[model samples]
Target: MPLAHPFDDDKLKEECGIFGAVGVADAANFVALGLHALQHRGQEAGGIVVHDPVHGFNSARRMGYVRDNFTSHEVMQTLPGNVGIGHVRYSTAGNKGQTAIRDVQPFFGEFSMGGAAIAHNGNITNADALRRELIERGSIFQSSSDSECIIHLMARSMGRTIPDRMEEALRKVEGAFSVVAMTRTKLIGVRDPLGVRPLVLGKFGDGYMLASETCALDIVGAEFIREVEPGEMVVISAKSGVQSHFPFRRRQSRFCIFEHVYFSRPDSILGGRSVYETRENIGRELAKESPVEADLVCPVPDSGTPAAIGFSLQSGIPYAMGIIRNQYMGRTFIEPSEQIRNMGVRLKLNVNRALIRNKRIILVDDSVVRGTTSRKIKDMLLDAGAAEVHFRIASPPTAWPCFYGVDTPQREKLLAATMTEDEMRDHLGVDSLKFISLDGLYRAVGEAEGRDPKAPKYCDACFSGEYPVAPTDMIEKGFQLKAAE
Candidate 1:
C-alpha cells in the first residue's frame, strides 16, 4: 500500500452558528440558551443583543463558548430586551487580526433608518466588492467582517423601509448566508437565494422566533414551526405576526451539507435531516466503501462517535472510545508566543493507552484541513503501543475556506488543497487513510431524511471547491489563491 501523509485527529473547528428570537418575555435569556445549544458550531466568541421598547437596547459579547460566555446569570441579567439575536463566530472572512470588541456581534449599528442589531451565520463572498462600492460613496466601516458590508449596502439602497432596504442589500450581495436582523420594531430573517445556509421559523406560545437550528428552539421551549423556505425572508413583529417573502426565487435549493455531517449539534435537525442520523449514515457508508477487519472501530472523539457506531455495526467491529478529549480545554491557551499555538491540540486530546495498545484501530473523524493536529494524534496512538492505526475521514478533504461564515485556514495552508490523499497520509504518519467520496457522503446524509420538513440539496463546495457564491476582496485576501471552487 502507498503510504502518504494522513489526516490529523485534532481538527480545527471552522463553522459559525446564529440564533434570533422575539416577542418572548425574556428574549435575551432565550437567545442565550439557544446559543448554548448551537455552541458546537463555534467556540471563538459569542454574543447576544436585546431590544427594549422603552430602555433602548442592551447587548453582551465575550470570547469563549456560549455556555461560559453568554449563559451566565450575571451576563443574562445585564441583557434586558423583548427582542434579541445571538451569534457564535468562526473566522471565514476575517482571521483574528483585530479581536477587538467592535468586531463582535450582533454587530449593532445606529443608522438613519434606525438602530439595528444583526447576527449572521454564513459568509457573504461578494462583501468585498460591496464594501468598496460603499466606501467610495463615503461609508465608514467598523470591522473587517463581510456582514457589515450588508448593512452598508442597505444604507445606500433607496428602499422605502428597513425590510425593503434589507432585501435590496441582499440582492447586491452573493454567497451562502442565513441572517437575523432586529430593527427598532420587527425581527427579520433572511436566507441567500441558494439557501447555502439554514434558517428556521419557530414559535413560543404568544411569541415567535427564528434560529439557525431547531435544537436552539428546543432549549427555549419554542416549538419548531418549519424550515424557512430557501431564498425566502420572514419578518416577525408585534403588529404583523409572521410575514414571509421571497425576494429572489431560486430554481434550486442548496444548503451546506457539512451542517449535518459536522457543524450542527448531534441532536439538532437541519435541512429537515437529523444531524445524528446523518452522521450514523456516514458510518454505514464508510463501512460499505472500505470495511476493515480490525480489533476495534473508534471515533476520534465526540464529533465522530455517532458515525463510529454505524461503522461498528455495519462492519461488525466492536466500537470503543480509544481517545479521551479534555472537554475543559479553554478557548484560548498559549504558553507565550505564536511559536507553539498548535500545542494546545495535544493538551485537548489524549490517547487511552490501555484501550489502544496492540490493537488494529480504525479512527474515523469528520474532516482534516491542516494536518498538524492529525500528525500528533497518530504519534500519540503509536506511542500508546497501537499495532496499527488506519484512518478514515467521514467527509472529503476540505480544500476551501467556507466563505459563508466558516473560518478555515487559507487555501495554501489547507493540506488537501495542495497534497493528494497519499501525500497527506505520509505527512500524518498513519498506516492508511481514506476519505469518503462526495457521492458516498451525499447518500449518507440524504438517506437519513424521513419526511415533513423540506431539505436543501446541499452545497459541498468546501470539499469540492464548488462555492455557490463568489468571494469578496476580504475573502479573497483572507483565503488567498487556492480559495476558489
Candidate 2:
C-alpha cells in the first residue's frame, strides 16, 4: 500500500481519532458521522463496535476511509446496537505503511466479566516491554498493533468489572493515551495523567458522547460539555448518567501544544481555546518576532491560511491566496513513472501566477519538518515569477521526534536536528526563513508570561526536547536524549 499521500509525507502524521456514544438508538450511525468529521486525523483505516442486548457484541472493520467503509448500509446494518465506539487509525505503533484489517481498532476481547472493545488514540511508550512480558505469560495476540496489548492486559486482570479491569490494565502502560471503550451497559472515556492527547465529552439527546475533538461532537448535533480531565475517567450509562474518577497518579497536565498549531480541526475548541484563534495568534507572534518587508503576504495553502491572515493583520499587508490546492485530488493507486513522480507538489498545489508575478511574497506555513515540501513550494512560486520569497513559520523548529503518538522520523532525518536556522534557509534557497520562538508559541497559546522554565503548561518536547515521560521502549532500543547544557 502507498505509505502516505505524497504531499503529506514531509509532515508529522497524526496517530488516531476515536468517538463513542451510549444511551442512543442506532448508535453506530452517530459513530459513523463522528468518525467522518474526524477523518483528517487518520485515513488509513476505520472500525466500529456496538453492543446490543440481543446480539451481545458486533464489529465491522475495514482498511480505508470512514466514508468509504462505515457509511454503507450493509456495514452499518451489521453493527446494530444502542451503544457503540469507533476508531480511525494511521498506525503509529505496528505495521506502519501496510495497515492490515486486523490492525484496525476498537479491538474486542472476551473477559470473565463479559466482553469489551477499546479504541485508543495515543501511543503506549511501554508497549514493547509489555508485549514481551504478556507473550511470556501466555497471552495470544491477534494483531500486530500495540493497542492489542490493552485487551490482553484486561483479560489477565483479576478485577470484578470491565472498568476495573481496564483501570488495572492501563496502570501498567506508559506514554500518551486518550481511550474510548465500551462494555455492555457503559461507554467509557479516559485520558493519561499528562493528557498528551485530546478527548472531549458532549451531550446528545438523552445520551452522551466522547470524541477526540469538539468538531466530532458538532457533527452529530451534540452539545459541548467539557474536556475529559487529565488522569480522569468518565463512565456513562442511561441509569448512572456520568460518573467521574481519577484512576492515575496526579501530575501537572501536559496537553500536547502542537494540537493548537496543526493536528486539530481549525473549528474545534481545545483547552477552552479556539484552535483557529490560537493559530492566528501564532502568526501575530511570528510577525512580532521577525518583521519583514514584502509586497504580498501569501499562505502556502489551507493549513497556512489562518496564520497568514493573522500575519497580514499584524503587518498591515494585504493577504492573498498565492497558492491554490486541488481539493479533488485523491491518492493514486497505480505506481507512476519517474516523470509523473517528479511532478510531486504540482499534482496537489498550483501557484496563482496572475497575482503573485513580480511580487515580493511572504509565505506563512505551520511548520517545516524535513524541508522537502518547503523547497518544492518555494521553487513553484519562483517559477511562477515571484521576485522574492520569504518563509514565516507559525511554530518553532521541530528538533526532536515525538514519542507520544505522533508519527515522526528518526532524529537524524529531521532537518532542524542537523541544521541551524540560517543553514536551513540557505538549503531551501529562500530569501529568508524564520520560525516562532518557543516562548512566542507558548504566548500564542495563552501562556501570557510565556513558557515557564520550571513547569511548562503544555508538552513542547518536539521543539524544546524536554520530554515529560522517558520513552522506555526507545531507551531499550538505545535512543539518546538531548545532553544537558
Candidate 3:
C-alpha cells in the first residue's frame, strides 16, 4: 500500500477495492482494468497476479496508480495464463511496508501445507490479536498487514484442503472482510460473517468473475451475473464449477452504505443499490432533513453531482456546476512530496466565479476524511466571490477509520474523530456544515427496514460505533508495523 505514504488524509477514502476471475481468456488485462475501475476506492498502489493451473503463480505488484504500477511490461508478460486476481491499495502508515512485498495484496504463502495468493478487501478488526496468537506459536510473518494474518491461520488449521483450511481460518478471524484467493488450481472467495464490505460475481462468456463493484464487470465486458451472497464461500475451478458455503448468519449481511455514498462509481450497483440513485436519495433526504436557504446548490464536482441533483429536485434550489474538476490530471502529480498534493488539488478543482459571485452557495460533497480538500475547496469558493459558502456533505462525518480492506485512516487522521462539527466548520472556513444524520442516511439508502434479503442491515460502526463482530485489539496496532510498497 505504497509503504504507508506520509500525507494528509482527504475525503473519507474509498481506499480501493479489488476484482478477479477464473476461466476467462483475457484474464490478466481484464483484471487490471477491473482494478482500475476501483481506483476511486484506492489510489496508492495496484497489482495483479495470474496463475496457470498447469504451471505456477506469477505476480506483478507495483506501488503507484494503476497506470504506473502496471506500466512495466513484465506485469503483463509474467501473467502467463487465465485464472487471476488483482488489487489496488491505500494502506496508511501502519499498513505500509519496507522491502517485503508480502504486504502487497494477493499475498502468497507456502507453509508445508500449500501455497496460494490472497486478494483482500475490508479490514480485520481482530488482526492485532490474531497476529499475536500466531506469533506466540512461533509464526514468523513476512509482512505487517493484518490481512496476512489469515495465511498463518490457514497454515495452522487442521483442514485437509485449501478451502477447508481457508474456511477454518476465517472462522477464527473477526471483523469485516471480503476476500478472493487463487491457489495453484482453484479460485476462492469469501465475505465476512457480518458482510461489511461488498463483493460480487460476474460471468464472462463461459468464465466466472468476482469483484468489489460491478463497474469492473462492465470495464472487462463481463456479463453481470449476481452478487456473492454475504456469508457465502464460493470456490470455483474447472473441475468443481462454482460451489458455495453459507457458514455465517443469514441476517449478518451488512453491506457498507458509504460505498454507495462516496466510494463506488455512479454506474456501479453495490448490493442491489445503484451508487448514483443512492447518492441522490441522500441528497433528497438532506433537503427534507435540513432545508437550507441558498442561492445555488453547487456540488464539489464528480461525486456530489448526483446528490446535488436530488437536492435541487427536493428544495427547488437551482443546481449549478460551480466547480470544474480537471479529470485529465493524473492522481499522482509526481513532483516531490506530500506538500505537492495540495497543489494537485488546485489543478484538480477550479471554482466558477460567475456562478458563485455574491451568492449563498451550498457545496455538496460525498464525505470528508481529513478535511484537507474541503478546507481548500471552501477557500476556493470564497475566493471566487461566494458570499455565504455553506458546505453540505452527502454522507455523515467519517468518525471511525475502517480497519478492513477499505483504506481507512488512523484515529488521529479522522477529522471527525479529532474535531467537533462546529470546529470542523471553522476549520474548513465554511459558513455552515452539516452531515446527513445516520438515520436519514439509512432511510435514503433503503436500509431503515433492514429486512431486505439482498440488502440486510449492515454495520455502520464507522458511524454508530456498534461493531458487528467482536473485534480484537490487533487492528488498533495493525498499522504499527506498516504494509509494503
Candidate 4:
C-alpha cells in the first residue's frame, strides 16, 4: 500500500489526471512531462502507453510518483511512438488503499480493429452494475479498477473503428468521465456530458495534446486551444488533424466546483475564469458575509494564500505568513517511531512564532473535512502564543461525500455532516469558525446571480448534498439522498 500523506488524509482527493499527445516525436516523453505537471491530481501510481508503427503498442506502469518512476531514460526508451496517452492515479474505486500495479492506468485492450489505451479521470456511478453484467456475460476482469469496465465494454461493441466502439461503449455507462485514449495512429479526448471533470485541448507545433488541466499544457509549451465541451469527443491524428463529436445527450454542464476550491492547480483556468482569482474572490465574499476583528489574516499555507490575501484586502487586516510549510517535505516522509507518527501536522506545517505571537489571527483554509487538522492547527497557534485563532474556510461546509472521482469519507466521518456551524467552532477550540456560504462561493466563481435552486451552474454536491448525477451503486446499497428542504 502507498503511504497516505499525514496532511492529505484530512482532505478530499481527486482520482487521477490524464494526458495524451499526438504527432510529436517520442510523444511518451511529452506525456510524462504533462503527468509531472499534473502530479497534484494523483501521486500513488502512473502509467504511459505509446504506439510505434514498428514496435506496436508499448506501456510502462509503475507504482510511485511520475518523476520517481517515469523520468528514467530506460523507461522512456521502452515506449517509443508519435502518439500516446498517460495517467497519474490515486485510487478512488477499486482496491482503494491497496492499489496494485494492475490497477494503474492507461489500461490497454486488444481489439479486432487493433489496440486502444485509455486513461480515465472520473468515477463511473454504475460501474459495479456494469462490471457484474460484463462478468456474467463472460468478460474476464483484469484489475479491480472501475475504469477497466470501459475496455471490456469496448470489446463487446460491434462498431468497426476504435473510436466508434468507444462511443458505443461509453453510451452504456453512466457517471462522470473525462477520458484520454489513443489508438495506433490517433489520440482521443472526451468529457462527460455535464463536464463534471475538466479536459482541455492544446496544440504543440504540428502535434496536439489533451490533459486534465491547462497547467499541464503550459509545461510542454503547448498553446491552449480551448476546453473540450461537455459531451464532446475529439479524435486527433497527424493525418486528419482533429475531429469533434458529441455522442452523449446534451444536459446543462455541471463542472465540478471543487476544482476551483482545491483540486486544480491555482495557475490553471476553468470555466473561462482564473482559479487563483476565483479563490481570491471567494475570500472577498467570505469577508463580506462574515466580518471578523483580527490583527492578522493568515493563510493555512499554499492552498489558502490567495484567499487570505483577498480576505486581508477586504477586511483591511494585515496579511502575514503566520504559518510556514516545509516545501522540502515529500508526502512519503517516513515516521520511524510512534512519537514521530503522532507528530503528524507538525511534520508538514509549523507556526511562525515571532510573527503571530499576541496577534488576533484569522486563518484562511480551503475546507475542513474531519476537523482533525483544524483542531491541531488551533492548538499549535495557541501554543505559539497567538491571542486568537479563527478559521475562515473558503469553501462551504463539506457535508456530503462525492460520488464523482473525488475520494471522500462517509457522511458520518465528515465534520460538517454531524455538527452545526457553532458546534464545529466549539469542537475545534477556535475563537470562531466560519465557511463561505454556497451562494457566496457561486458568486465568487463568476455566477452573478448566485446559484439557482432549479439550476446550479456547477456541481457542488460535496457542499450542497444535492447530487446532479444519481449515485446508482450507492443508492442500490441503501445510501440515501438529502430530503426536500
- Between candidates 1 and 4, the one scoring higher on TM-score is 4
In terms of lDDT, the best-performing candidate is 4
Candidate 1 structure quality by residue, lDDT tens digits, 218-294: 98889999988888999898677999889996657777777778777888887667889889989989889887768
Q: How accurate is candidate 2 locally (lDDT)?
A: 0.92
| TM-scores for every candidate against the unseen true structure | 0.89, 0.98, 0.89, 0.99
- Candidate number with the higher lDDT (1 or 3): 1
Clashes of 2: 0
Query: For model 2, how does the per-residue alpha-carbon lDDT over 95-180 read when each residue is reduced to its tens digit?
Result: 55778888889999888778899999988889999999999999988887888999999998999999999999999999999999
The Cα error of candidate 1 at residue 194, in Å, is: 0.7
Better of 2 and 3 by lDDT: 2
Ranking by TM-score: 4, 2, 1, 3
| Cα lDDT listed for each candidate | 0.78, 0.92, 0.77, 0.93
Q: Is candidate 1 or candidate 4 better by lDDT?
A: 4
* Candidate 4 residue pairs in backbone clash: none
lDDT of 4 by residue, 360-468 (tens): 9999999999999889889999999999998999999999999999989889999999999999999999999899999999999998799998999899999999998
Candidate 4: C-alpha RMSD after superposition: 1.0
Q: How accurate is candidate 3 locally (lDDT)?
A: 0.77
